[model samples]
Target: MLQIESTFDVQGDFGDSGLGKLLDMFRDMSDHDEDPGRFVVEKVIEKIPAPLRWAAEPFEAVLGAEVNDQLDALVPGAGDEIQAIAGALSDRARKFAIRSVLDVGLDAKGRKTGTHRIETIIQVFKEARLELPATELGDKLAPATRIPITLGAGEFEISEHRLKFPAGTMLSRALPRLVIPGVLGKVIESAALIARWFACADTAAKVAEKLDDPRAGAIAMTACASASKSISDQIEERLAKIDEEGRLRLEGSADEEGEGTYPAGGWRGAFRIDKEVEASIDPQRNTFSTQEQMATQ
Candidate 1:
């Protein structure tokens, strides 16, 4: 019940291991010629409780069949389209980029819990700039034509990551639609699934010691939502309205001042993870601060 309300945005490449591993899992399920159903139930759904294991049956049923082609089209080539859309949104937000890869290690016996690890890096630039055209005054005075502005550049490392998906809800809502047939159906299904995953994913990170402004948190969250929406748009324009079509809502369970948690609160729109200052930055009390940073502050 860590309810710190915020928007989360990710824009960048999914390292070879992040989304690639997920795709590999899907591909494995599809390519297991001998016993694809067993593979899904065993490798993929093994972590699910016994009673709930049946919940994922639909996913198992559809593997290694005609759906393979549709799945291929849906998740083509290490998610290039997804990265492109995220990058565009990141550029639009003027925020840092995120490079991540998630790896889940299933138990060999298919009866034990697995390990889920997410490695993420935040690529921050010291400043952002916009060039201006030379004017008569500038030509005469030799004034600078480009303006450098602060863009909240700071290094952050996600020391740990956690995923909290409602298995029942995901399976029930998305798996049913998987049988709709055609690539569009697969896209729609995948879109819903991805959106939910974004909403459910959480991270624990260390940031620059000076990064204490709540606006950074809000901006990050908003950017993350926009990034997720961009992915939805890539899948299908109409569904870009994910908030409405996908029932996407971000809720938080924290108390006033954004410092409390509610464990029993079933659904959370925002989660606040404990953070530590990984590094310290001295801006020289505005001496080294850019005009943009001063204004934002």
Candidate 2:
């Protein structure tokens, strides 16, 4: 058998040319703030190449109007100084905003994870290998199988004898079936409750299949807004109970320390409280609760 091992590098590349342009625009705006007609504004306008100038004209007009409106609302006086600052900053901000939307990893930290680095190296190796010339060894090995084998860049036909395999050799086939663990089964059941609020069909059935439960189809059909509400209430109750238990533990610890010797702030007081507050207001947290309820239902 001819083996063609290959690797693909996935780390990508560095450089934020788009972001750099944005920073430059911001700098120019700052520099032109004092004198509205500074060299920076003209330099910025001039920086736009002739080919892009026509397309950018409409954007420039819109940006100017937006700057004027914003400055009028923000600053008391719509003076030349304000206009200059606004114009320069607005232009840069618009460009940067557009760039940000287009650019992935714009705010990613410099740290390269092992997975990313490994993928990048693999891709580089693959590119390097593809540059190598094809060998005659690959051509010679193509004709000995039952399946017709095409070898070399040019398409050439091979007979069935070229692809023959020994009888009774096991042919591995992948089984396509849902394999839900106990924990994930519960999660799917809970998510079904949330899915009900969105009028999702087959939520119960999907959950049942995931859990390998007999009543999955029936339960999925019965999932509704009321079921979602019940799940939400259950989650809230559990969280409250957990909170009360934690508080009791803290109070007990404080009592043991005698008067005026309570621990000011530990894990619960600091991180836990903040986390609870954040969770209470977070939309994602509510969604998670809904999902959990559906999965467990």
Candidate 3:
């Protein structure tokens, strides 16, 4: 529980950073006919600690692709520049930004809310008992707009963080049962449908799983298709397809010349599983022999 107050120098250090890039981008956009939006400006202003000097001890890429999209939308054509600026950020500065981003507090203006939603890294460091360098040099430079700088969580360490994969295990159990009938029936009814399911792995990679190796991915997918074939189709039989109206009809045709014949224009499948069920534990269970019971006695 510590609070320190000092004017944050926005233009000097960040003149070559994303802050600079953003200003330059806006100027460029202004030069054109683009008005990005007042809402976007407010959003950025609310989140980033403008012109703050936060240092990362060693350069690292912590921002994910999600941030990349945000950056691109806010300041187009600044990817390389932002990367370069981030690479050049001091270790302490990087630590500052990350800490700020990790903290939970209102913005200096209280416009945005969430951890890392407001404030700069160094401001965060000062709260963590970090001794900050004097801003005498920046004091000499022309002051850019002053956005209030507040810091967040005073300290954090995520180096040992983990991602436990409950998802893969959950799906392995659930998917086999949930998808068996639809997938296997489609594969059997149209063998061509198997290719779609194989391709579906690629779709899932695009939307669900992150695939690292294409060859291994192919092997895994092939294995999945193979496993599905083993558990579902090997023990099951063709069932009548539900009609467009959602009715179940008999799949077999009767002879037209006899009473069993179907009409000439009618369509029907060749096979269907008899679905009458007679399940009971007493009926299906094996009875013990009298000698076995006597021996146990």
Candidate 4:
């Protein structure tokens, strides 16, 4: 009897076919029409606002139309009025945002959602100037002894008395899916659903305050609560639909009996594919790097 063992490292190359498939898949996942990241980015970009615009908002909350007129810039009562309203909405906005975020919806276990909502609030506070109080969260923020904590972004001061407050809008604007990278792609997908909710409460507050009706605040609160629930439900549904579509990308529809494997469908409709893989591990590069490159070559 003779025993023989044979082994060969074929290291087959995909030539052009594999590269073509990969490119097709990449294109499919990135297509604005089909991509959740694109969907979310566009939506988020709409809400992020410009940095200068963001900076102006707090001032508006403080001064309203008082700051509107150039001539009124030095009005006798201007500083007093600004001081009155500057921190007025900060606490209220924080409360409204925190409440709205907690309403994101429940998980499968019938428990409340994760900390993303709180984190969003924290991020908003950190990046933007809010009237700092002696409270715990307030203490975490960069102090603004005067008004404008930053004159403008990257230096270039405007006025000595204007305060040097900076804005987080630039950061918000920076997150849109102009290019769409890894897990951030997943975040972008949920941006529209979550982002608007972040500010809707603040908006409702602003509108109520502007109306100057004693009952308007209560009325808006009720209406906003109702509306927020509906929006949360909508977001939950949209995420579910995306997950179903994304499933096809991650591991293909399971067998009818849910046993055997089927052909892969790459990451077509999936935006959160990274969620399935470990952090620092990109599913695209791992799957297509060596094998697909060799085949494409």
Better of 2 and 4 by TM-score: 4
Please give the distance, in angstroms, between residue 202's alpha carbon in candidate 4 and its true position after superposition: 6.8
* TM-scores for all predictions: 0.19, 0.17, 0.16, 0.22
Alpha carbon lDDT at 172, candidate 4: 26
Model 1 / residue 218 / CA error / Å = 42
Q: Residue 248 of model 4: what lDDT? A: 12
Q: Which ten contiguous residues of candidate 4 have the minimum total lDDT? A: 288-297
Candidate 4 TM-score versus the reference: 0.22
TM-score-based ranking: 4, 1, 2, 3
Whole-model lDDT values for every prediction: 0.26, 0.24, 0.24, 0.26
Model 2 residue runs over 4 Å out of place are: 1-16, 40-292
lDDT assessment of candidate 2: 0.24
Candidate 1 lDDT over residue span 65-151, tens digit each: 322332345544313332332333223222222111211122344321212211221223223222112221122212211111111
The best candidate by TM-score is: 4
Error of 2 at 85 (Å): 5.7
Model 3 per-residue lDDT tens digits across residues 1-297 = 111121111112223332233224324322311122222222222232322102210111221233334445544543333333223222212222101112222445553222211122132211233322323212321122222222223321111111111111211122122122333434324422223222325322321223233443444444435543543332222111111111111111112222221122111211111222111111111111111110110
Off by over 4 Å in 1: 1-44, 47-67, 72-191, 194-273, 277-297
